[model samples]
Target: AQSVTQLDSHVSVSEGTPVLLRCNYSSSYSPSLFWYVQHPNKGLQLLLKYTSAATLVKGINGFEAEFKKSETSFHLTKPSAHMSDAAEYFCVVSARAGGGNKLTFGTGTQLKVEL
Candidate 1:
């Protein structure tokens, strides 16, 4: 199975500033990675994903991530921070190589945006 680690438990940014949520992955094979966001009192929504195709994957709401093989990292970033972007972000990896094609999620990073 693949393991994912979110580097930060919480990240705070001012409005209009850049946002970054770091994630590192470990797997025996090239596994699929995804980023999901959950707003306050809302369900989780897909943000972005990387599946061995292009290293740079663009997702919804102006969010994007670059998969770096050498570094084993897939960090999410946005050029500007919005108040509505405050949410919990999860990093997920596929466990297909291990047996079943299930998605395993790691700890989430809570983002806070201030005025």
Candidate 2:
């Protein structure tokens, strides 16, 4: 079984400041971790992903995350925040299923950026 836990339900930051969102995961096998952002009434967009190739992975919009197998963690971070960054973020975990893969999504972290 695989599961993901988002440490925070909401995170607020001022524009130009840094942003951080924490996540923890559990899996019996090596799991693929991903961060996705969803804006108001918009489709979900992939922010970053860890597919067992690199421990530290970078993604679009100046976002990055490091996979810590020992700690069972994959936390997302950004050097600077933007107003457009305000959205709901999800930490997802995927592992091998019967014949394919199963994806489990975190509850979500809503980001609010203020000027």
Candidate 3:
């Protein structure tokens, strides 16, 4: 079984400041890790994915994560925050190779931005 734990359930930031969200995972097989963002009344948009090949992965909206096998962690980071970046973030895991693209979502980390 594979499981993902998002360290923060909420993050608050001032506009233009950097954003960071922490996540950790446990997987039996080689895992595909993804960070997704959701705006109000919208579906999730893929932020990035970490395949076994790359340690550092970049995604849309200036989000990025590094797959650290030694730490069992995949943490999302952004250099700046915008009001538009205020949304719900999810740490997702899939055992697609073993179980298919069925996704298991984290509880969610709500990002709030101040002007």
Best by TM-score: 2
Candidate 1: deviation at residue 63, Å? 0.3
Q: Taking the tens digit of each residue's C-alpha lDDT, what string does model 2 give over 1-115? A: 8899999999999999999999999998889999999999999999999999989999999999999999999999999999999999999999877999889999999999999
Tens digits of per-residue lDDT, candidate 3, 22-82, equal: 9999988888889999999998899999877779998998888999999999999899998
For candidate 2, what's the RMSD?
A: 0.8
**How do all models score by TM-score?**
0.94, 0.96, 0.93
Q: Rate the local accuracy (lDDT) of all candidates.
A: 0.93, 0.97, 0.89
**Candidate 3 or 2, higher TM-score:** 2
Superposed by TM-score, candidate 1 places the C-alpha of residue 14 at a distance from the truth, in angstroms, of 0.4
Model 1 per-residue lDDT tens digits across residues 1-115: 5788999999999999999999999998888999999988999899988988999999999999999999999999999999999999999988673565888888999999999
Ranking by TM-score: 2, 1, 3
TM-score for candidate 3, please give it: 0.93
The order by descending lDDT is 2, 1, 3
Count the clashes in each prediction. 0, 0, 0
Supply the global lDDT for candidate 3.
0.89
Question: Which of the predicted structures, 1 or 3, would earn the higher TM-score when compared with the native?
Answer: 1
Over all chains combined, what TM-score does candidate 1 have? Answer: 0.94
